[model samples]
Target: MSEETTRGRAAVSGVAWRRRWRVPEKYRTKGTARPEGGGRSAGGDAPAPIRQWPLLLVLATTLVGLVVTLADFRIGLLIVGGALLTGAVLRAWLPAVGMLAVRSRFTDVVTYAVLGTAVVLLTLMAEPRPWLEVPFLSDILRFSVD
Candidate 1:
């Protein structure tokens, strides 16, 4: 490709990348302290500082998994539950333990644990039911303003 076209493609791709990953948006540089009024306020839908989400996500995952696992299944449940707990705890705390780029482990643990728990609960509950719903979409919207 010609130099101009190559530069144009690169610039366009950069925009796509920035939009796809809200954290590294064009206006805000990653790893720098966010401006006081830049992102969504504490009460808004804007992503929380990278500092907060993992622990929160981990705790939620732990609770959800604990509930579903407890609600169903009669065999070796404790062992499985404990393993999920370990993953959730790891997700929640590991970042603080060893500084990292983002708090995604919490999501990973929750994804695995929750999905697994759901399958087990459905399989064994005999009359499967949701322990919780998707949570308040409004609450999430309220959190992402900036």
Candidate 2:
């Protein structure tokens, strides 16, 4: 390809990337934060920062699971697994996930669902007694213990 054509392609790609990932201009200025209403407002009426409620709920669930771990490992596993699965569902279905919407929607959904599934499977086969048997996972777990 000619140098001029390559440069033109690069410029076009750059514009696409910026449009996809750049923070909105309203969010750029610290002094004029966009309120929940999502419009520019005078300093006197600036709205509160938008909170990522789904992310907060996930964090709370995980913390509760950690606390429960002190009493019973299996129950803790169940709690954490449920939390992760809930997160996956939210990420997959919600149009706007607030701060939790980090990457592209498809990527985020896949990541959440995969991680949640793994956690659920591991929890079911966790120690104190395996609730579901996966031959490969059992072999790996035994190998690690030995």
Candidate 3:
């Protein structure tokens, strides 16, 4: 094809691509979807860290749990679970939890609660002691394996 025709076709293709991938009005307005409950944990006048206290708290607790994990696996797991549970509680109770609000209030709460509970339960059921054994779980495992 001629150079002019090639350039014309390329321009048309680019236009078509742009139209195909055009962002919606809502997304174009903000360019990002802020989490449903994500608002400043503290006042607007507060510093960035203070405003994001909930997220910082959760991250700090998780970090502590990770550090503890290096020394005591079970205890560390419990701490991690506690941290997640704390996040759930904070998300549920607080109207504006800054970065801690990853989704809608209900969704974030449910996710945190479920994950925290699972972690704690699994930790309790760790081998050599099995603090929170469920008799049916063993039966189910055996049935599935068999």
- Evaluate all candidate structures by whole-model CA lDDT and list the values in order: 0.51, 0.72, 0.93
Listed in order, each prediction's TM-score against the native is 0.26, 0.58, 0.79
What range of 10 consecutive residues in model 1 has the weakest lDDT sum? 34-43
- Put down candidate 2 lDDT per residue, 45-122, tens digits, no spaces: 433333456677777898999899889887886788788778778777765556566566667667777787788788
Which is superior by lDDT, 1 or 2? 2
Clashes of each: 11, 0, 0
Local error of candidate 3 at residue 11 (angstroms): 7.4
lDDT for position 120 in model 1: 50
| Rank by lDDT (best first) | 3, 2, 1
Candidate 3 lDDT by residue in tens digits, 32-126? 78888797888899899999998889999999999999998899999999999999999999989999988889999999999999999999989
Please, what are the lDDT tens digits per residue for candidate 1 over residues 6-41?
999999999998888785456774586532223222
- Compute the lDDT of residue 121 as modeled in candidate 2: 82
**What is the Cα-based TM-score of model 1?**
0.26
The Cα error of candidate 2 at residue 146, in Å, is 10
> Which candidate should be chosen as best, given lDDT against the real structure?
3
